[model samples]
Target: MAKYLDSNKVYRALAFIDPYGMTVNWESIQALKGLGIDFWILVPTGLGVSRLLKNDGNISEAWQRKLEKFLGLDRQYIIDYFYQRRSVSTLFGEETQINKEKDIVTKIGNLYTERLKTVFEYVSESFVMKNSTNSIMYHFMMATNNHSGLKIANDVIKPKYKL
Candidate 1:
């Protein structure tokens, strides 16, 4: 679809609504950036981080394998790299500190922040959408630079609840 859009010169910008932002190819994204194509990514931030951390039934193993196949890296290597990059060591002193052990929210927020930093150059904007209630949705926008693209995304793909 990106190739088609590039060949036909059809799209002005591309918005990727990725659940985890793990499957994305940064090289391809960089190439698209070279072509002057704008991007907005709606990355899952809060609950998704908790889910990944909990990994109750080896579900994360499946995701790990999938990511390994996509990124062509060892699962353990990926885990180590992501953890090292996203570690809140300064905030909590050492890895085994009591404060770090208890504050899952801060840990997850730092993880998401680190992930965002990795792609800071490629994307014009990113958003984190949290489930406000069982039915309602709330969005927190980040890295917002492309005003027009953000406007388009808010208008077209904003979630609707069946209330």
Candidate 2:
């Protein structure tokens, strides 16, 4: 789809909204950003973060294979994804160990927030939407090139998804 947009010369500042932000390739995202394509990514917070960290006893071999493929890495990267230090080290230059579930949730949120800041010129926390079944509110990040696009996204799109 990015290739199609590029071929047709469509550069009117588009947005890609997705729940699986972790699965997205940052390199491809950078290429699309060069073409004025912004990204609104949903960060799985609360229980979702715990599930991902623990693998939830539901991750099958097939699911692991799919995750590996999505992340474009081998098994070691998958291990690192689950076991790596989850902290605000990049921003604060100090690593705080995450030992509890609440700490893990906070760390995941901080990590993604930092990632959005690192990748985009303008980043905003659009809103949080609650999951009906689990009753967990997941945070969303809106990454854009300029303030106008961020305004449009926050004023228009953000309200629609507000819980």
Candidate 3:
């Protein structure tokens, strides 16, 4: 998997080929392992960038950089976003418009999820991968930049601490 990773956009990608070979997914999985993580909290699990590239025929550089930043952020917020989130309530806070926007974000995310499912079949699509994931770890961040949720989260979090 290291070979696949080497060609991707991750700035400092790492993978272990010892004892049993490691895909960085190990780190993410560990984060969610025993924290009573429920589906509602984490919603769409997995990294969100490189993984989503295949489906996005013409990705914008801005979007690419955004996901890179998301990966760079600690997974602590990810788990916290879900399991400990008062997130939804705060956003949909007695506001019909917020509810409407929330619904739209959900639908968009589902579309991305469907697109991501077949990414492996098109691994060859990336100019970098060039049909090489058959033997390497690619840090495909499959997480969406779900701006709606992110904004809500940022707002909710700021109240607990200064922005």
Candidate 4:
């Protein structure tokens, strides 16, 4: 699609990326930078990103690769963003422990939104999606260069509970 879009310079598009897991690479999305496109992406916040973020901050190589690819960020950066290090006094000596931050899903959503802003001029607030257990599972967001499109998307993406 990137190649096709590159060849068709005059084509404007509305692109939606629906990934079941951390399958979408940040580089793929970065290819759409400055294009005449309004993009909507389904970020698997709880199911993918949060699941990869271990409580101890000891992310495995595979998980680190997945996160680095999906987020286009360094593993250390992601770790620092999601976890904090605290010193604990043990019997032997002082030890540092890694603690995962609270409300991580919201932080992940905000991170992805900031990433979108790097490519597009305007980004709409996320439309939060939750599971049957009311756990936040995904965040749907829109990125566009057009301000009018962003305004319309912001209005449309609002969660409707009563209806």
Report the number of the highest-TM-score candidate: 4
Native RMSD of candidate 3 (Å): 19.7
Over 24-143, each residue of candidate 4 has an lDDT whose tens digit, in order, gives 999988888888788999999999999999998988999999999999999889988999999999999999999999999999999999998999999999999888889999999999
TM-scores, all candidates, are: 0.40, 0.53, 0.18, 0.92
Tens-place lDDT per residue, model 3, 4-49, is 3333434222222221212223234333321211111122222233
What is the clash count of model 1? 0
lDDT of 3 at 3: 46
Query: What residue runs in model 3 are displaced by over 4 Å at the alpha carbon?
Result: 1-30, 39-56, 68-163
Model 3, TM vs. native: 0.18
User: Deviation in angstroms for 27 in model 2?
Assistant: 3.7
In model 4, the Cα lDDT at residue 60 comes to: 92
Q: Where is model 2 poorest over a 10-residue stretch in terms of lDDT?
A: 96-105
Ranking by TM-score: 4, 2, 1, 3
Provide the overall lDDT of each model, using Cα atoms, as 2-decimal numbers: 0.43, 0.57, 0.29, 0.91
lDDT of 2 by residue, 1-163 (tens): 6566544545555565564535555455556543455677776656454454553334567655654544344655545545544556567697745333335555555655665666577877546555677454566777876678788767754565334
RMSD (Cα, Å) of candidate 1? 8.1
Q: Which digits, one per residue and each the tens of the lDDT, describe model 1 over residues 39-158?
A: 544433344333454322233677666545434457665455344333246665745311112344444444444544454432222233445564212233333234565466455544
Off by over 4 Å in 4: 1-10
Off by over 4 Å in 2: 1-10, 20-22, 46-48, 55-98, 101-103, 132-134, 156-163
